[model samples]
Target: MQVEYQAPLQRLNTFGIAARARCLVRVRSEDDVRALLRQPGWDWQHTFILGGGSNIVLAGDVQRTVLKVEIPGRRLLREDERGWLVEAGAGERWHDFVVWTLQQGWPGLENLALIPGTVGAAPVQNIGAYGVELQDRFHSLDAIDLETGETFTLHHEHCAFGYRDSVFKHDRPGARGMGLRGRALITRVRFWLPRRWRPELSYQDLQRKVAETGIQQPSPWQVLEWVCAIRRAKLPDPAVLGNAGSFFKNPTVTAEQCADIIGRDPRVVHYPMPDGSVKLAAGWLIDACGWRGKTVGRAGVYEKQALVLVNRGGPQDPCSGGEVMTLARLIQTSVYERFGIRLEPEPVCVG
Candidate 1:
């Protein structure tokens, strides 16, 4: 509960943006959070909940008191006839947790390996990779109500999980509103790992690995290894090149719209969703608009993956969040002008 004034945040964010929090508090436990909430004249609305800082862009120094979550723990809460229930503190690194589960013979999370950020941030974005989303394995979560200073729990339905979205990403005024965006702080997350597990290779990248290796029946650990390798080759390492992984969500279009786009451009990359909608590769769209390997100010699109935007200036002269947003806006405008589809940024921007 120690409050540090004017805390340096350059190293805190994966983007390596030079910024500082006006006031910062590192919450290592639920007691720390409760103590902060009980402070005299404290205002939760004037606070910002920061996790690993992986899915955020800081335009400038944050004015709000930043609550840096660092709660850490991992355990198998229950091993029932149904499945194994595992829980992790909000602050635990997501990739590390995934690997830990596999090491413990819990294989449900293998497909989501190598994603940046912490367990708490997973539900906020409904993070998905290699054909498995967080909600697919989520059991429940414990969180604190920022306004009430009380703790509560939310199951998958209460979370309102969607593709890269959840109630935590929204803001609603009334208590009954579905959105919980700025009103709650997650402290712990639990996952239900099935007793029987199967490898998910629906994602094209994993399929390619199967083809190259000629291994039809891959184990969960094997799938994890393949996912890590594919991500390493495609995505730029944040430690080397500052980036927020995929910069945009794959836009879903109607079958008719897909046909129209294909008729115009024969090589458009797309896949059919189970719901019958067509999911277009946002990277393909950006490349079609000629944005790959392009730069704007100190921000640039990654040469390896068009979906990722990187800070070309490096740590010494890192790109500001404004530069990233500017480039994002330019890409969005061009994609919309050419393809009649708007590109939505994935990261939350703050200043």
Candidate 2:
């Protein structure tokens, strides 16, 4: 375990919000995690597990010790007629891992290329894009119990993943409900890419790409190229613009409720889910309320996509965490008052 006192976190987080950790420890291995747990002053209960810092907004100088997971390794554990068992350290970059799988001729993860953050954080967010979610490829994962210092392995069933949510996102007790949030520190993740991988072009953007290119059967790498292109053209790169890809979760409503919404606003973009619930386009809802390109203090809604809240101020005068949340809350209030549905943020906010 590598330790640093009063670590500067401006560059650590993708949002570019300046913050500091009172103490930061980088665990390169599971043994390192155990070593960290044995430290005298470390407080496990308050320890914040930071991955790539892509999907977070640092509220201020964090009081708790930060466990910056830096474990790194990746390999094909095995392969068979069923599928290829792949494993990666928690600290491996999510996008890099996806590209690695494609290069290795493992086609299933191609649609998720170019996403930000580390592999360990993927399951916590159930990261999805172009109709493919982490749950679709996840085999299992290894995590350490911060409270007990005991290691455990959990399969997909134990994860209890929902739309951009998992057990890891919830705090036990209070809102307990099968939540393992703030408890397990994920160390590594394994994926099962099946032998018979198929393309997922059901999403509108991908379908449009297919239509424009006239490529009926695109290769996995070709699909990856398309996904990367789509993301680049849509979402702002964190390297240049400080923003988490999507700010709000797409709200799902019953068919009757959607029907009422459609009656009131015919142009409201919505999709009928297989479960009979209609998924409303959250960005469309925000845009309909005329919030696109609007700024609130240093924080503003992205001009291109209402779903993304960006730091309008550059590094010299970066937007604070408060500004981002304030803008988010204001947007949420407007959408709720007008549309009667709450918009949940995608990133984990911390101080």
The segments of candidate 1 whose C-alpha lies over 4 angstroms from its true place after superposition are none
Q: Against the unseen true structure, what C-alpha lDDT does each candidate score? A: 0.93, 0.91
lDDT of 2: 0.91
Candidate 1 weakest lDDT stretch, 10 residues: 172-181
lDDT of 1 by residue, 7-27 (tens): 989888888889999999999
Cα distance off (Å), candidate 2, residue 190: 0.3
Colliding residue pairs in candidate 2: none
What TM-score against the true fold does each predicted structure earn? 0.98, 0.97
TM-score leader: 1
Residues 1-351, candidate 2: write the lDDT tens digits.
788999989889988998899988888999998887787775678889899998999889998889898889999999998889999999999999999998898889988999999999999999999999999999999999887788999899989899998889987756435567777999999999998978899999999999999999999999999999999988899889999889999999999999988998999999999999999999999999999999999998989889998988889889999999999999999999988989989998999
TM-score of 2: 0.97
